[model samples]
Target: MRFLVDECTGPAVARWLEEKGHDVFSVYDDAPGIADSKIIRRSHEEGRILITNDKDFGGKVYRERSPHCGIVLLRLGNERGQNKISVLRRLLEEYAGRLPDQFVVAAAEQVRFASKEE
Candidate 1:
């Protein structure tokens, strides 16, 4: 799946996805310190799902609705990027189409999927 990996997601997640043959773009890679609003817009325009860990995006989406491909907010209990990467990969494999719309937000304990109703 195409994705816009957030800055917080780290390079490890991005690399893993790339190895999986998914077209992934990272905020820290091409651009650094970009505003979330701009990232949201660009991701939507590019038809890429956003892979973020920022809880604030919920508010952002609430206040400003953009055509976001989708947003996966990660919250792995372990802050360690390695642990988070494992969870993320599992989600990506399990959730294919269902996620493109309502993506998974990884919390400390479990992963929650929140997508819009069709």
Candidate 2:
């Protein structure tokens, strides 16, 4: 799976994602200082899911139907790389394989999946 990690996410997370063979790009390196909407659009255009701690994306992508290959809205209290990696690992282990068709949110206490009916 391809991913576009937000600047809030640390470098180790990016490296581990790449080590897993996913084409992962950090917003800091690729879309540095870009707006959320633009990042969402870019991720969609690149066929990559977005990993972000910000909740605004959930509203933008799910409520407004913003373009995104997929959405993984992370909610890690501590922004440390290790915590992020652990949360990411659990999320991927649980749903990355069986991910649904639309935007998804991986929160600290819950994992929410939303998709439009075909």
Candidate 3:
């Protein structure tokens, strides 16, 4: 899978995804401090899933109808760095196959998926 990892997601998540043989581009390294709209446009142009911790993307994607390849909004309850990485890693390991073309929320205990009809 191809991913455009947002700044708040941190380097750990990007590295883990790369290690799993997925193409990962991180805003922290590639375009530090860029605006979210630009980043979302880049993700759409590149056909990469936008993986972000920012909840704003959900509103932007749905209410604003932003163009995107896909979206994975990590809503992990734990704010610790390790906890975030762990939950994301587990989500990728267990549910990656179900992620494309959908808006997904991955929390510490559960994963929720949403699409246009839902």
Candidate 4:
């Protein structure tokens, strides 16, 4: 799958996803300091799922009804960097096949999936 990693997410997550053979674009390296709306627009235009730690994306996508391919909001809190990465890795490992066409909120202990219908 292709992904646009938001600036709020750590670089390690992008590196790890690339290592796992997914096409990954990281805003941190590609376009530093871009606004959230522009980043969301780019992700939509490029047909990429957005992986972000920013809850603001949720409001923009859902409340504002922004167009997007998909979004995965990582909601893990107060964890070590490595632990956060591990959570992301586990999410991909367990849900790679089911990730598309849905909005996913992945917390440390649970994952919630919502679609346009929901």
Error of 1 at 117 (Å): 6.9
Question: Which whole-number lDDT from 0 to 100 does residue 13 have in model 2?
Answer: 83
- Model 2: residues with Cα > 4 Å off, grouped in runs: 116-118
Candidate ranking (lDDT, best to worst): 3, 4, 2, 1
* Predicted candidate 4 versus true structure: per-residue lDDT over 13-97, tens digit per residue: 7887898898999998888899999988998899899998889988887788888888898887764557668877888889987
| TM-score of decoy 1 | 0.88
Best by lDDT: 3
For model 2, how many clashes? Answer: 0
**Native-to-model Cα distance after best TM-score fit, residue 17 in candidate 1, in Å:** 0.7
Which tens-of-lDDT digit does each residue in 16-82 have in candidate 3? 7888899999998888899999988999999899989999988788888888878988887676667
Error of 1 at 53 (Å): 1.1
TM-score of each: 0.88, 0.86, 0.91, 0.92
For model 3, how big is the CA root-mean-square deviation?
1.4
Superposition error at 14 for model 2 (Å): 1.2
